[model samples]
Target: MKKKVFCVLIYLQFCFIFPKTSFPGFRAWLSPYRMALGGSGYLSFSPLTNRNNPASLKSKKTFYSGLIRYPSSIMGQGLAITLPKKERVVGLAVQHLSYGTFDGYDSESISTEKYSSSDTWINFYSSKRSTWDDLKYGFAISWFKSSLAQNQINAIVFSLGLQLYLKSIDANLGISLNNHGKVFSNSSNSSGEMPKETVISSSKKLKYLPMKIFFDGIFNSRYKLDNINFGGEAKINNDLEFVWGTSLNKISQNTRQSFWKSFFAASGIGLAYNINSIKIFYSSFFLGTGTLYNGVSFEINVI
Candidate 1:
């Protein structure tokens, strides 16, 4: 069918057109809602969805959101505030990841003082509807800072995205370039290039069911890595929803293990509840290495 052919062409383009390079940092999950949906939120309706696709930054109301994540000693958290201005929406977000405290040792492995490591990102983004009613575009600029003991590095990152709504299919399609930036450091050993990625994503609401399906194709040019993520969100009621999803990396990462084991290891699940103007979300997913991570977030509409 025509749909099948179009899908194949897109896959081929992602596989062959992207160049290989090292992976970039700052790919951490920021929203529990999107995380539960298998990390495929480029076309989500939620304003708090991943900012990697800046085109999704539209909301009729101003709101603030916060989230926290736990994966053993590594902790992650983020905060975001969004406001609509005329036909455009603008937002600010900050995220932090802490790698816990570790004992620093010299080359001789002698005892040393305890030290901590962390990464932080401060982002400013805006999006607006195109002259064409069905199109939207957005851009983001971020400042990144990372520290391990005394050594630290700073970087500037940029993201751009476009989204289109197909009225006939009742679906949304989006494309984005993320984490393209310059790294600054006095250290000679560190690479000065950012890990850049291209993402194509789509989402659809089934006509006969109270559910929405999502798909994302993410290509990392630096590392030559490609990931496909798919998931679904089912409405339990007007105020409650259940979500489940998985990615290709989760299914095939542990080839030595049983197929089902690897499949379950990569799966993610979560729930969302709305109480008046406040919404709460929770998500749980496993890393490729089988580590489990849990996150919770809260959003409140200010006006």
Candidate 2:
């Protein structure tokens, strides 16, 4: 236990002290649950699960989740509310990321002031579940915004998702196309194309054990077959759970020459505690050799 705790501390230190920039394009920070589970949330039932696979939004209860990421001190919070009627279900979600302050530099590399960056997403979705076939389909319209030092970029995207549940096998298959939209405004830097991507994911529950496993395949328009992730959760009891997973695609060596040569890739472990209608989760993962990513989230169920 002592050794494990020490390892966790070391990882957090690494995350806090390392370089802090997410990969370009659709490779932003993920939710704690998704990151903990090896980047597989396509089949998850969490209200925030739709961030990755919009089709996974089948919850009847409204949910609020807040997460914090290390290294860059990125903070994210989201809310998902569902309205269920006899005919169909309508869901609305909002997610936002705020990157902490940074030292600004001039064209000549002179230190200036400090600046902060942020990103936000708003999604409106509708989902329908087929009673006979146990199939669900969801579609969403999303608006996204990214803010830098003095420029703000905004775009609108449409996403479609499908999910199938096999009760007899206790398994689910999910797929989604996310961030397909028009770029209304171009930023100061580059073209105005939203980071569009597709994800294929599945989850399975063991009949004889208290474990759930998930697998995901991610494809980005700019980088095809960028990531493959696998993860699992083991319930220790009614209130405690253990989670572990890893991303198969390693971080690029270009990010940090030294860090890339030391660690394998992205891998992490998490623990969750649930009490009544609220759950708290914590996870840590390797981003590169010396860079680590630590995340924590609090989720609550309302209604």
- lDDT tens readout by residue for model 1, 1-303: 343344334323223323243222254555677778767766774434334588878665555565645443456677778888989989888777665566668999997897776778888888999999899999888888877688787888888999999999999999999888888663435664566788998989999999999998998765454788899999999899899888776645564455555766657889989898887888887654455668888878887
The C-alpha TM-scores of every prediction are 0.85, 0.79
For model 2, state the Cα shift of residue 71 in Å. 1.7
Q: lDDT scores for all predictions?
A: 0.72, 0.68
lDDT of 1 at 147: 77
Error of 1 at 270 (Å): 0.6
Steric collisions counted per model: 3, 1
Residue pairs of candidate 1 with colliding backbone atoms: 21-222, 21-223, 22-222
Q: Which residue runs does candidate 2 get wrong by more than 4 Å? A: 1-25, 45-51, 103-114, 187-189, 222-224, 251-264
